[model samples]
Target: MSDIQDRHDSGGSGAGCGCLAVALLLAVVAVLLGRPFLTDDGDGGAQAAPEESVVATPTSERPRSKKPSGRRPGVVNIFTEQGLRGVRAAGTGIVVDPSGLVLTNNHVIQGATEIEGTDTDDRRTYPAQVLGYQKSGDIALIRLSGASGLKTAKFAEKWEVRLGDVVTAVGNAGGKGGTPSVVTGKVTALDRQITATDQSDGSSERLTGLIETNAPIKPGDSGGPLLNTSGQVIGMNTAASAGFDLEKKGASRGFAIPSAKALEIVRQIQRGEASDTVHIGRTALLGVQVRQPTTPSGGRAGGAYIADLIPGTPAEQAGLRARTTIVALDDEPVDSPGSLTDMLLRHHPGDTVRITWTNAAGERRTTPVTLGDGPPQ
Candidate 1:
């Protein structure tokens, strides 16, 4: 997790400066609690980076432990390599079915070209493929190859959760591959809402009806189980407050998506119901990075400006180039990069769509391009 930096006034009286500093210190930054492990080259290739160490120091008198634990039959560590930028990310997942159906956060495997899972039960690594995902709800389902007879996670039957209930969170903290980390705390609130921002692009999404707890859930814990006293999962850990001092007691707080809501989305995905927010299969790629362009007066332009195009992709083969603006897709207006992504999600590989763009010469051009199979967007 990274801090959301805020600019503060430098000039002030000593007492006023002290007050402002205190206010800044108390401000909470909600961040998605997952660790991305690899850096990206300018082109779409991964460059190896040093692994991040776990933050194991306790924040309270009742210390959280990072020691290796016994086999967690249902939990697995997930590793993903993104297709476009070649960045690798790590997170936790829970087995929902014996046939290796895993449930995790959408952001954990988003844009992944390859996925692998290491089951804690047997410490065996297996290849994985995305089944479906609901981007709006931040939920996703994946299947591990050649896996069977695995233990499935136990869900609370009644789905009853209350404030002050003792709970434990288990996950692959710091992207460490082995026995997951364990942290215990109490549920502090329910039906909470938080704005989760992607550190890479600063894009944000609102997560509502969350279960808030005082657990020290750290990076790499996303999609792990938030269990009750009986060890039945009640929620899935998702986000947490960033930049908490390790020595400060009770300074950390975590948020989770309730299991009931997550399961609902999972069932929808299993049924192959593709909605406005749910994508049924692998993403279709236009293969161009886009940004908002600026006019001569320094105002935002109307269309998505092409930043770069991947080699041998649909956009490149169709003669799209950097510095142009994509105005429409299949006659649908593309006002921004997000709009273009949303439109692409509605289509699949082999689906041909007409694209309209404005070149550097100010000439508008239209062409039909067949979409290609790509990683999740």
Candidate 2:
């Protein structure tokens, strides 16, 4: 069950459409595990294309209910821009507080320079700002600007969920902006675990204690609600089985973070508690994409290779360039890209640190580089 494949859907059209296609593939999956449900618009600019359509097929064990009369009161459709790179992504979020506090999967808002949330009830779009996030747990909290008295989702008690319980997975499936998609099924398992690998950066993290269902969760459902029979939120939809085509298949298995666990993380974020796993605010950037070096024998060669440096970033301002190898950060040795990322995560924007690197000509150089604010990692 450990084998997982992440699939990227690029069916939509636009200027940066290809990026959205690639963004969908960024979901981490293990063997047979589906990618996290975040949809992309392809263009990173103001003009965005609508996400392709997604159809959900309910189980035959019970008759499907008629479509609800109106949109879910607390749920919102989420859209994000990743700087000027022209990559737009869409997902779902749950309103947790009346003052516009929203909860969602960290991946939904990861790397976003701008975020917008359209309430299902009001049909009004509001700008949003990330309050905090726990990247390891894949949970994030955001606040909508000028929002008040918003309806909040009801949470089911932790003891209320049981296997074989009927549940509905609701989300902005396929990144469609209007009414959220809903599919019903029974919970089949609990306490599930999986490793989600980000295809874009080869980074992966382990997710544990997930609720498993056959509710046909689809693209753009990430961070949406998995509601119990009484319309109480029991879990947050996170991932699904790869290639579970709803049009061709009756139902597909999906995974969700239990509401209890998600709520715990949210409480920590609300308390402004920053830990090894929780990031309190905006991400800091050295502004370089790096990779681990390999020797001729295919073994890792110590040091992170600077594949490219983003122009106008701290790395570029420090005179670091592509093809150089970063040896250390703040005097600590950097063995690989992951290690460098870990080191960076410990510091915040406006923090200055010593950087050590070697050029292609085997020339060693060291300097002080002040980090810059960047999109979420």
Highest-scoring model, lDDT: 2
Q: Candidate 1 regions off by >4 Å? A: 1-72, 198-203, 240-250
Tens-place lDDT per residue, model 1, 1-377, is 11112211121111111000011000000111222221111221122111110112124334323332322459988877654553455678999999999999886776668888888887778899999987667799999999998888887665356666688899866666577778888877666656554432233566676777778887667789988776778788876323222223535677778887888888998999999998898778677766666789988777777767778888889887777888998899987655677788898888898889998889999989888887764
Superposed by TM-score, candidate 2 places the C-alpha of residue 49 at a distance from the truth, in angstroms, of 41
How high is each candidate's TM-score?
0.78, 0.80
> What TM-score quantifies how close candidate 1 is to the native fold?
0.78
lDDT of 2 by residue, 290-357 (tens): 66667769887878777776677888898887888888987899886666766777778899988899
Query: Cα miss at 94, model 1 (Å)?
Result: 0.6
